[model samples]
Target: MQKGAEAVHAANPDVLVILSGLNFDKDLSFLRQRPINLTFSGKLVFEIHRYSFTDGKSWETGNPNQVCGQVVNDIMSRGGFLLDQGYPLFVSEFGADQRGTNVNDNRYFNCFLGLAAELDFDWALWTLVGSYYLREGVVGLNEVYGVMDWNWCDIRNSSFLKRISTVQSPFQGPGYNESRSHKLIFHPMTGLCVRRISFFQPLELGPCSESDAWDYTPTKTLTLTGTYFCLQADKSGQPAKLGIMCTNSNSKWQAISDSKMHLSSKLQDGTNLCLDVDSKNVVFTNTCKCLSKDKTCDPASQWFKIIDSTRKQNTTKSFFQSKQIAQFLGNTFSYIL
Candidate 1:
């Protein structure tokens, strides 16, 4: 395996040389002893496979959460340790049989997701298409596991996509730290993995005073009247208002009416504050920003900043304060018109 990996590295210096079939057993100390043989400038990713049925009935016994937790811990102990040592851990394959009802699949999925969340690992589902020619006499595949149906014309199981979408989405906020590791959002209904901002924080309407109550809505869009302060506060109680909305345009925030505010700009890179002046409504766009190898941004500003000695030291604390401000403002003035 080492020789093969080294050969690949020698051939393609810029490609990731992945070693697969580490299988389910997971004792990989051999990797440590291997000499650096790569003739390339790429990374090495170690891959593993996991499934609910791997241990037979383990997932079926005991408290679901407890059992699943143990399973995840066991997997991590045996294989996940490699990841902690600066090596990448990839769950190259995982999924439940589609023969069962949505309930069973959902339960299994929850457990899978919980571990994925706890570990923050990268992975790929079993497959994109249905109808695998397994060794067991070409077993008719389950619609649940296949992202698409046998004919490739219909989506066999959309909920699967939805469940994974939350796991794959990049939008990170208060109620969604577990799901933030997701880098993409898949719209099951459309079968498209378009980039999106998942609103992790539940909208808080109580923070707004009685006068501001009109601006709060459970829906994503908000309506408001006149200029209003859009504040964001974090866990520490510090608050920061990105800006006060006076006029709506295609650039800043979208104006639906003289008094309503909706998101016109993308929130994937920054917090989008959408408000309407006439109706006193508001929408918080908690989009997650993807950074390039050379780009870095302040979590508070979601904008890139030049790195300086003094700036780097202060960024962590300041970023925390800014997050607190954004959260507090979201909680406090969500309804304040």
Candidate 2:
């Protein structure tokens, strides 16, 4: 790999060289023992790939929370650790079925988006072409993972596109300094965040760009930044509101379930309620759903990912430059792992 990288540099020194892990670009832990002897510096980037099928039917058979945690831990140990070592890690390939009907793919994607938001790594969608003319003696073979339809005219899933828009911009990294770390209550199902319109208004799900900055305190209270109000639970079907009473049982939220995606809190009536959203995007606290091992139930409305962000509004640098670390080197980062 080092020799190949040197040759590539010898041919074109201006381009960045990316290396992939073994075992089909999924394992890079071997780097801990046998570091690459690359002579080139600043142009070295590592890549990794992940997909729903990579772990078989784990999402279908195991608990979603446990499955998500296990997959994230495995990913970190495999290649995500490079980010901590000051190396640029590229998620070269990662996608799920765009149709959104497959149970396994649907559940896996929810977890995938949450991790992607947290990592904020550079990534490439799995595919673009929806259909091919010929492959293995087939005509017009369809690519279910393609972002576009089979005709390549319209997007296959518009909501899917919106869901990924949050991570398309880097939340925090080098070349950024104005951002103060805060939490954004991201709903993976809708690619939106919990936002408060006003002190007197109820909370609602809106664009992440307009999400209210929040601070999850050590006391389990989710308080709005620069405000004394905490997210308080009301009746079972009532919209969640901002309240000054921070110590009350209704304001203290606990991340329940194995995935820890369910932000559950007690109501004034002692009812255990989870943060949920209605069809109109109104945020509320409802009796928790699918807290057990029920595969048929869809708990998407209740799955909230508290993503950490340090992106301050009104940064002057160009938006493109802040998207990926590789952009700093004046090269478009794209590589297959």
Candidate 3:
């Protein structure tokens, strides 16, 4: 592999040389013992592939939080650690069944998205093609993982596309000059973030780019950055509101599930409720469900991940105004944006 990388750089020094790890491009932990040596400095990249099947039905049987934590740790130990070592790491292939019925794939995606948002690494979806002309003696095989429909006329899953769109832009890193740190309550199932319209209005889920910056304080209160109001709840099924009385137990949130995705708070009556969204996109608090061992229940609606970001709030509007500017920013940030 080293010789091949050297030859590629020798032939074309201008192009980046991406190295793949052994064991189907999923293990690069070996590099920790022996670093790569090349004449070039800035153009070397490492790549890895991951999927729901990579760990063989673990997502189906195990708690998502535990499964995700274990998998992410393994990935970091493998090739993801290279990022900490100052080298670019690319998720060359990662995708899920877009049909939305595969339980394993569905569970894996929530876990995968959290890591993606945290690391903000460069990645390539497994494919764009909806169908194959032939594969292994089969004719016209349909690719369930493809982003497009088999006819190639429309998106196979628009919601899935929307969910991934949040990570399409960089939250930090090169060309992202923002220095302020804040949290965005991201809903992987909806591809939106928690947002507020006014002081007394109920909170709603909206475009992540318009998400309100939040602070997860030491007291476990979710406060709007630079504001006195904090997220509060009263009943188990009422809308989660912003209020100045933040010291109450109803306003103190905790990550309660194994996946640590469910943000729960104790109601005044001692009932534990989780952050949730309704069909109309209203954010609310409801009875915490499926904390563990229950695979039949779908907890996607209650899953909220509070991810850190350093994105400049003031400049994001301009970045969305022009496609040219968005593309320029993406390129200028190098491989990770």
Candidate 4:
């Protein structure tokens, strides 16, 4: 494999040489002992593939949290460790059945997504064609994991795309451009974004690009950029408006759930209210409703996706592999986008 990689590098110094994990490309534990040496600089990348069935030891039968913890550890031991090594690692393939009835796949997918969000790892979904033109001796073979419909006219699953879109753009990473110094609050449901016109103004929905920059502290306080105005809540059932940066409980909010879809808080009345928008497009706290249970529930007004609005043009250090450089290199280094 090294000889082949070296020959490829020799042919084109700028071309990326991809090294897949050993044994069905499931793990790269060997790299911990032996790192690859390419002929060129900044053109080596590692690739790995994963699926719901790969780590199947019964993710459905065990406690989701416990199983998720165990599986995450295993993943870290395998290809996930590459991220810590500061080398670009791509999830060359990962997907679940689009038919959406596989319990193991569904559970494992949630766990996988949680890890993907935290690491901001680049990835590519497993299949793209809903039905194959031909495979083996069979004609018109169906690929349940495909992103497109059987006719290839439209996306097979838009909700899945939207669910995965949260990590589509990175929040924190080595290559984050600091020039913008802003974060946009996004709610995928309505596709409307949260923004502010000025200080002491009510935050409203707008184009995500036009959204205001917000600062989310570890303590869960959201303060507007370059201002003392922090997000706080008024009485329950009322629109949450901007107020002075307060040390009280009203300013506290948190991203709850494994997917971090729910931005919720506890009110003085002890009701667990979530940040939501009514049909009138007003921001307020309401009951923490289920997002995936009912598509007709129309909870877009409640979901908030906080994204980094910075330029991300700069690379932090050698640990940081710029996505642009990876793209410039070649398709050998696989990624979703």
Alpha-carbon error at 94 in model 2, in Å?
1.2
- C-alpha RMSD (angstroms) for model 3: 9.5
lDDT of 4 by residue, 1-337 (tens): 7898988888888777888887789889987888776556677788888887786755556545455556777778987888787887788889888777777777667667756655667888887888888987779887888998888889988877766765666656657665566565666544556766533345677654456668887888887766566787776677776765457777888876434556777766667777887776667777776534332233334656565556332223332334533443344234324
Q: Estimated TM-score per prediction? A: 0.48, 0.85, 0.86, 0.65
> What clash pairs does model 3 have?
65-258, 65-259
lDDT of 1 by residue, 34-104 (tens): 53455453388877777767656654443343444466666766577776777777778887655445333
Residue 246 CA error for candidate 2 (Å)? 1.1
Q: What overall lDDT goes with each candidate model? A: 0.43, 0.83, 0.84, 0.68
Q: lDDT score, residue 223, model 3?
A: 91
Best by TM-score: 3
Local accuracy of candidate 2 as per-residue lDDT tens digits, 221-274: 998887666898988899998766689899998888766789999867778999
Which residue runs does candidate 1 get wrong by more than 4 Å? 21-42, 99-105, 132-135, 138-144, 169-337
RMSD, one per candidate, in order: 16.6, 11.5, 9.5, 12.6
Whole-model alpha-carbon lDDT for candidate 3: 0.84
Q: Local error of candidate 1 at 240, Å?
A: 24
State how far residue 141 of model 4 sits from its true place (Å): 1.5
Task: Give candidate 3's TM-score.
Answer: 0.86
Worst 10 residues of 4 by lDDT: 312-321
